[model samples]
Target: MPDAIWQKSSYSAANNECVEVRADAEAVELRESDAPGLVLKADPSVFADLLRTIKAGELDHHA
Candidate 1:
Protein backbone atom coordinates (compact mmCIF):
# COMPACT_ATOMS: atom_id res chain seq x y z
CA MET A 1 0.00 0.00 0.00
CA PRO A 2 2.98 2.26 0.58
CA ASP A 3 3.53 2.22 -3.15
CA ALA A 4 0.29 4.12 -3.77
CA ILE A 5 0.27 7.87 -3.28
CA TRP A 6 -2.45 9.18 -0.99
CA GLN A 7 -4.53 12.20 -2.01
CA LYS A 8 -6.80 14.45 0.05
CA SER A 9 -10.20 15.67 -1.11
CA SER A 10 -10.26 19.07 -2.82
CA TYR A 11 -13.29 20.04 -0.73
CA SER A 12 -11.36 19.57 2.47
CA ALA A 13 -10.79 22.65 4.57
CA ALA A 14 -7.46 24.26 5.39
CA ASN A 15 -7.41 22.36 8.64
CA ASN A 16 -5.59 19.04 8.71
CA GLU A 17 -8.75 17.09 9.39
CA CYS A 18 -9.66 15.35 6.13
CA VAL A 19 -10.04 12.02 4.43
CA GLU A 20 -7.43 10.51 2.14
CA VAL A 21 -7.55 7.97 -0.65
CA ARG A 22 -5.02 5.55 -2.12
CA ALA A 23 -6.07 3.48 -5.07
CA ASP A 24 -4.65 0.94 -7.46
CA ALA A 25 -5.87 -1.78 -9.82
CA GLU A 26 -7.04 -4.08 -7.07
CA ALA A 27 -8.88 -1.87 -4.64
CA VAL A 28 -9.38 1.63 -3.26
CA GLU A 29 -8.04 2.39 0.20
CA LEU A 30 -9.22 5.18 2.46
CA ARG A 31 -7.93 6.66 5.68
CA GLU A 32 -8.22 9.74 7.82
CA SER A 33 -5.39 12.29 7.85
CA ASP A 34 -5.25 12.27 11.65
CA ALA A 35 -5.00 8.47 11.83
CA PRO A 36 -3.04 7.17 8.89
CA GLY A 37 -2.60 3.67 10.26
CA LEU A 38 -6.27 2.71 10.13
CA VAL A 39 -7.63 2.05 6.64
CA LEU A 40 -10.87 1.15 4.89
CA LYS A 41 -10.88 -0.86 1.69
CA ALA A 42 -13.44 -0.97 -1.10
CA ASP A 43 -13.61 -2.13 -4.68
CA PRO A 44 -13.20 0.56 -7.30
CA SER A 45 -16.72 -0.01 -8.58
CA VAL A 46 -18.14 0.28 -5.09
CA PHE A 47 -16.20 3.46 -4.48
CA ALA A 48 -17.46 4.95 -7.71
CA ASP A 49 -21.00 4.06 -6.83
CA LEU A 50 -20.58 5.68 -3.43
CA LEU A 51 -19.26 8.91 -4.92
CA ARG A 52 -22.11 9.00 -7.42
CA THR A 53 -24.65 8.40 -4.73
CA ILE A 54 -23.20 11.10 -2.54
CA LYS A 55 -23.13 13.57 -5.40
CA ALA A 56 -26.69 12.76 -6.34
CA GLY A 57 -27.93 13.82 -2.89
CA GLU A 58 -29.02 10.33 -1.97
CA LEU A 59 -27.11 10.36 1.29
CA ASP A 60 -27.37 13.98 2.37
CA HIS A 61 -29.97 13.22 5.00
CA HIS A 62 -27.17 12.42 7.41
CA ALA A 63 -25.75 15.92 7.27
Candidate 2:
Protein backbone atom coordinates (compact mmCIF):
# COMPACT_ATOMS: atom_id res chain seq x y z
CA MET A 1 0.00 0.00 0.00
CA PRO A 2 2.97 2.26 -0.39
CA ASP A 3 1.35 4.04 -3.28
CA ALA A 4 -2.14 4.04 -1.83
CA ILE A 5 -3.92 7.31 -1.21
CA TRP A 6 -4.52 7.52 2.50
CA GLN A 7 -7.37 9.47 4.04
CA LYS A 8 -8.15 10.37 7.60
CA SER A 9 -11.45 10.86 9.34
CA SER A 10 -12.77 14.40 9.00
CA TYR A 11 -13.65 14.34 12.69
CA SER A 12 -10.05 13.62 13.64
CA ALA A 13 -8.31 15.84 16.16
CA ALA A 14 -6.37 18.90 15.06
CA ASN A 15 -3.14 17.33 16.26
CA ASN A 16 -3.26 15.02 13.22
CA GLU A 17 -2.56 11.89 15.23
CA CYS A 18 -5.31 9.75 13.75
CA VAL A 19 -6.00 6.59 11.83
CA GLU A 20 -5.73 6.63 8.05
CA VAL A 21 -7.34 4.33 5.50
CA ARG A 22 -6.70 3.33 1.93
CA ALA A 23 -8.45 0.92 -0.39
CA ASP A 24 -7.56 -0.93 -3.54
CA ALA A 25 -9.19 -3.55 -5.72
CA GLU A 26 -8.03 -6.41 -3.52
CA ALA A 27 -7.98 -5.05 0.03
CA VAL A 28 -8.32 -2.13 2.37
CA GLU A 29 -5.37 -0.73 4.28
CA LEU A 30 -5.27 0.98 7.64
CA ARG A 31 -2.47 2.74 9.45
CA GLU A 32 -1.87 5.26 12.16
CA SER A 33 -0.78 8.72 11.14
CA ASP A 34 1.91 8.66 13.78
CA ALA A 35 3.14 5.26 12.67
CA PRO A 36 2.60 4.95 8.95
CA GLY A 37 4.96 2.01 8.60
CA LEU A 38 2.68 -0.21 10.67
CA VAL A 39 -0.19 -1.24 8.42
CA LEU A 40 -3.22 -3.46 8.70
CA LYS A 41 -4.96 -4.94 5.70
CA ALA A 42 -8.38 -6.54 5.59
CA ASP A 43 -11.00 -7.70 3.15
CA PRO A 44 -13.44 -4.96 2.19
CA SER A 45 -16.42 -6.80 3.60
CA VAL A 46 -14.61 -7.48 6.84
CA PHE A 47 -13.73 -3.81 7.10
CA ALA A 48 -17.36 -2.89 6.54
CA ASP A 49 -18.42 -5.22 9.32
CA LEU A 50 -15.88 -3.66 11.63
CA LEU A 51 -17.22 -0.22 10.85
CA ARG A 52 -20.77 -1.33 11.52
CA THR A 53 -19.74 -2.92 14.77
CA ILE A 54 -18.05 0.27 15.88
CA LYS A 55 -21.00 2.46 14.92
CA ALA A 56 -23.42 0.11 16.64
CA GLY A 57 -21.34 0.18 19.82
CA GLU A 58 -20.86 -3.57 19.75
CA LEU A 59 -17.41 -3.06 21.23
CA ASP A 60 -18.52 -0.56 23.84
CA HIS A 61 -18.26 -3.19 26.52
CA HIS A 62 -14.58 -3.63 25.73
CA ALA A 63 -13.99 0.07 26.03
Candidate 3:
Protein backbone atom coordinates (compact mmCIF):
# COMPACT_ATOMS: atom_id res chain seq x y z
CA MET A 1 0.00 0.00 0.00
CA PRO A 2 1.20 3.50 -0.82
CA ASP A 3 1.55 6.05 1.94
CA ALA A 4 -0.90 8.49 0.46
CA ILE A 5 -3.16 11.07 2.00
CA TRP A 6 -6.44 10.88 0.19
CA GLN A 7 -8.59 13.88 -0.65
CA LYS A 8 -11.84 14.31 -2.51
CA SER A 9 -11.94 16.38 -5.64
CA SER A 10 -12.97 19.99 -5.17
CA TYR A 11 -15.23 19.69 -8.17
CA SER A 12 -17.06 16.82 -6.58
CA ALA A 13 -20.53 17.45 -5.29
CA ALA A 14 -21.95 16.47 -1.92
CA ASN A 15 -23.66 13.36 -3.24
CA ASN A 16 -20.70 11.00 -2.99
CA GLU A 17 -19.03 11.93 -6.19
CA CYS A 18 -16.41 9.85 -7.97
CA VAL A 19 -13.00 11.42 -7.73
CA GLU A 20 -10.21 11.70 -5.19
CA VAL A 21 -6.52 12.56 -5.04
CA ARG A 22 -3.50 11.61 -2.98
CA ALA A 23 -0.37 13.64 -2.59
CA ASP A 24 3.09 12.26 -2.04
CA ALA A 25 6.65 13.55 -2.14
CA GLU A 26 7.07 13.30 -5.90
CA ALA A 27 3.65 12.69 -7.37
CA VAL A 28 -0.12 12.78 -7.10
CA GLU A 29 -2.34 9.72 -7.03
CA LEU A 30 -5.88 9.82 -8.32
CA ARG A 31 -8.59 7.36 -7.43
CA GLU A 32 -12.23 6.78 -6.82
CA SER A 33 -13.19 8.13 -3.46
CA ASP A 34 -15.59 5.31 -2.81
CA ALA A 35 -12.94 2.77 -3.78
CA PRO A 36 -9.94 3.65 -1.69
CA GLY A 37 -8.12 0.50 -2.69
CA LEU A 38 -7.52 1.64 -6.25
CA VAL A 39 -5.14 4.38 -7.37
CA LEU A 40 -3.76 5.95 -10.52
CA LYS A 41 -0.36 7.52 -9.98
CA ALA A 42 0.98 10.50 -11.85
CA ASP A 43 4.20 12.48 -11.80
CA PRO A 44 4.01 15.92 -10.20
CA SER A 45 5.56 17.67 -13.15
CA VAL A 46 3.18 16.05 -15.62
CA PHE A 47 0.22 16.77 -13.41
CA ALA A 48 1.26 20.39 -13.16
CA ASP A 49 1.48 20.65 -16.90
CA LEU A 50 -1.94 19.02 -17.24
CA LEU A 51 -3.40 21.55 -14.83
CA ARG A 52 -1.78 24.37 -16.72
CA THR A 53 -3.18 23.11 -19.95
CA ILE A 54 -6.65 22.84 -18.48
CA LYS A 55 -6.39 26.35 -17.08
CA ALA A 56 -5.24 27.66 -20.45
CA GLY A 57 -8.31 26.21 -22.19
CA GLU A 58 -6.17 23.78 -24.11
CA LEU A 59 -8.65 21.02 -23.36
CA ASP A 60 -11.37 21.73 -25.88
CA HIS A 61 -13.66 19.08 -24.53
CA HIS A 62 -13.90 20.86 -21.21
CA ALA A 63 -14.73 24.11 -22.92
Give one digit per residue, the lDDT tens place, for model 2 in 1-63: 568789998778999999999998789999899998999999999999999999999999998
Q: Is candidate 1 or candidate 3 better by TM-score?
A: 1
Candidate with the larger lDDT of 1 and 3: 1
Tell me the spans in candidate 3 whose CA falls farther than 4 Å from its real position: 61-63
Assess every candidate by TM-score.
0.88, 0.88, 0.74
Best by lDDT: 1
Native-structure RMSD, model 2: 1.1
Q: What's the count of clashing pairs in each model shown?
A: 0, 0, 0
Q: Measured by TM-score, how close is model 1 to the native structure? A: 0.88
The per-model lDDT (C-alpha) reads 0.93, 0.92, 0.80
Residue 41 in candidate 1, Cα distance off native in Å: 0.5
- Candidate 1, 1-63: lDDT as tens digits: 678999998877798889999999889999999999999999999999999999999999999
What's the true lDDT of residue 40 in model 3?
Answer: 81
Give per-residue lDDT, candidate 3, residue 46: 89
Residue range 1-63, candidate 3, lDDT tens digits: 266567787788888867988776688888887787777888988888998998888898865
| Candidate 2 local lDDT, residue 2 | 68
